[model samples]
Target chain A: MTAAEERAVIDRVRRGETEAFEALVLDNQKKVYNLALKMTGNENDALDISQEVFIKAYTGLHNFRAESRFSVWLYRMTYNICVDFIRKKQRTPVSSLTYTDDDGEYMDLEIPDTRYEPAVEAEKRELREALSRGIDELPQHHREIIVMREMTGMSYEEIATTLGISEGTVKSRLSRARQNLVSLLNSYGTFSKSGRHKTGKEVEGHG
Target chain B: MADCKKYMDMISCYADGELPEQEQKLLLAHLDGCASCRALLSAYRSIAEAAEETLVQVPDGFAAGVMEKIRKLPRRRSGGWKAVRPVIISFAAAAACLALVFTVSPQRFDFGRNKAKMSARVEAPDMADTAERGTDSVLMDSAVPEAGSGEFGGTEAAKSDEESLFLYEAAGASADVETPQTGMATATDSPAPNGAATDGQPVDSTSQVTRHPGVKLGIAGVDENTLVIYYAVFTFEGALPDHVTGVEKTDRGGGLYSLVVTADVARELINEGYTNYVIGNEDAETALVYYTED
Candidate 1:
């Protein structure tokens, strides 16, 4: 929906029209859930966080202020809720940890469809798993910035505003995060040196 | 050629298309002559591509699940007596007592010392230890009425104390304060500096005294409207709390510390064994609790 339509929906939700919130939930849930998935690396935890974010947004609808885009505000809430969830998970003992049933619901979009040949599918799965592992290894702040920039595609301005940091800090931090990811992928032997060279040539030719 | 190291750092920004026109042009020119830089740029691009291509799909009915949960949440009531219940109760109780006293003895209502004693009788339990600690003396210095300023009946003294108490209650009710700036008091032994008051009011040390079981404590001079209280428990001496919830701390120069927490978190921290002192009324803009342990 356009920004104006989203604002109208929000206005209705704030005016005691509870069902109007569903439009917002539908519009933003994918990005919000994906962000949680990327940040937490656990599908159940992502779902839990995503649900919690929408619930919080519904309750906090009156505080929306409409100063920034609704999506930016919602993303900020998602980021903070994920951070808190991570902190809570760290505090909880492993014995008390519980996992939700897989239920075949959460899917990794990067996984190739059945149409792909088995060998290509396996390689794609390996590459995707390696990238996930690489992302998981990053420190929380770096992971957050990477997800915000890379996964969510937020501009530096939106990220800086969400994180309450300078755009300069965002740039430097994002650079550091990417470098760390590259080093990790390299260490895992996911990308060969020659492969990188070939990729460079292809990109340069395109440029 | 542009220095490889300098341009290498800019490659990520260039890859993201964040660099200014001149810097992008410079980096592009450098890349043409530099093989290693080109490889680095390519690696950065690859990483970016990999990151972008990485997408996680939500479970089916994800939005529906969220909507279901939201529907289960109890609906919040619109403003009414329910919204202002606490304020009404406090004001009604205070007024009722005043009315009872006036009906019993009209002459007694005009006595400043009697009024002071009555207010003290109502306020003393909360401030008793603070008075004994001499913090009240420091606080009174800032707020005590001049000799001829109608000490008990003076609007200034009454208003300031009432406002101070009101700010405190308001803070306790709402735990929403801006992040407080750390002040420069580092030594545990040194007195809090002059500007440490959260609201820029002279810290009324007497107004915020809390008597814990064995310790007589004061929040020194925090303004509730601008600061929230954080409950910090250091496992060892000088260690920070392991899990801080909504609140964040500001180092007030010495061993003294100030915390800012949301009103909800502040309420949770209260009675959780942290030294609790409040400053601000119901109308106060922020809820701030200044906590420290002896």
Candidate 2:
């Protein structure tokens, strides 16, 4: 949502127009849901966490300090809820924890855009599956930081403020998180020789 | 160098555009020339894109689910004493119930837990007051107490009050730095008994260890395994400015000492070239007193 539009919604919500919150829910639902899906690596858990996030947002709206943008705050809430879920799951590991990446191995990007081609779609599906597995394997802190940084495009200071941390810590954690993800992906053998291993190296280098 | 740690540290900030623009440009230029770096950057972008793809999709009826919960929450009556009455009544009832519980089953309340709780309650008020001062020093004298012993159990409330006294005294150190008339606990050369005064207190427990030769400052409410500290105070050549606070006094004890500063000031000091102190005893300081990054 545009800044102006978000502000308008916030103004309405602040004035007891609780219905206006639906506008927010509808607009950011996709991104929020996507974040959940990535973090949980399961559609059902993702959906559950996304709904839980919105619910949490609604109840905790009173605590929202208007110093930063609402979406930034909302994303932080979403990230935290997901983390809690992951932590709880870690304590009581479930059968789903060991689920294999069913999607095929190859990321065949060389194929041209052929209409109605099953092969290309299959490759895409496999790539997505591999990506999900790689992400799921990342340490919780690093994964969430990456999701917030890359997916939401929040600045370091903004993320820091949202997470109640120093920007230096955020930067440091983010660097570590990315480096960890690169190693995880490399270990999984998901990347082809074509600039695949180097990507992680470069990220590690820069981080 | 094949293993350049500094360059590795820049990637995360670089990805977030946190580096200076010129530094970012330089990094990008280096990436353009460095095949290994280019591949890694591309891989990072891909991974980020993949992460973006993985966001949780909220199910339908999410708003309804939330609205339902909101509806169940007890609403405050509109305006004035009518609205405030329920809160007061609930609080009174809660207090009565707690009193009855303790009276009926006095043994139910573990003395140590009760003491800790009491101290916690007392310290909260002092924390609020210190927080208002902005530069107030926070002194937390946390004791795990030996296993199967309750020496401090009955004195929890009084000791908590003492903790507040120490906090108020520590805040005084800040008073000279910023505001004046913080509290009256004059500075002294000898370290007080740990049980007597927070600053000059005498050490009663042989096990009570001194960390870094002074008190430390840090935030509470972090997991033990993942203790993350954002602040630490070390030596200074001259006396602390009248407006500055140190957690401990320097040799000669000339200036008002404040062991800890707010996280904001701590960050600034770090950026301006402060050092992280490495202490010997981990068990000596409470989790709140020591800071670390997990």
Best by TM-score: 1
Candidate 2 regions with alpha-carbon error over 4 angstroms? A33-52, A82-125, A162-165, A194-207, B1-6, B77-294
lDDT of 2 by residue, A31-108 (tens): 777777666667877777666666545544544555667777667656655654665476322222221111212121
Stretches of candidate 1 above 4 Å error? A91-127, A194-207, B76-256, B259-294
* DockQ (0 to 1) for model 2: 0.21
Clashes of each: 22, 37
If candidate 1 were superposed on the true structure by all CA atoms, what would the RMSD be?
A: 15.8
**What digit string (tens of lDDT, one per residue) describes model 1 on residues A147-204?**
8887788899888766656787787777656655665566676655432222111110
Evaluated against the true structure, the overall lDDT of model 2 is: 0.43
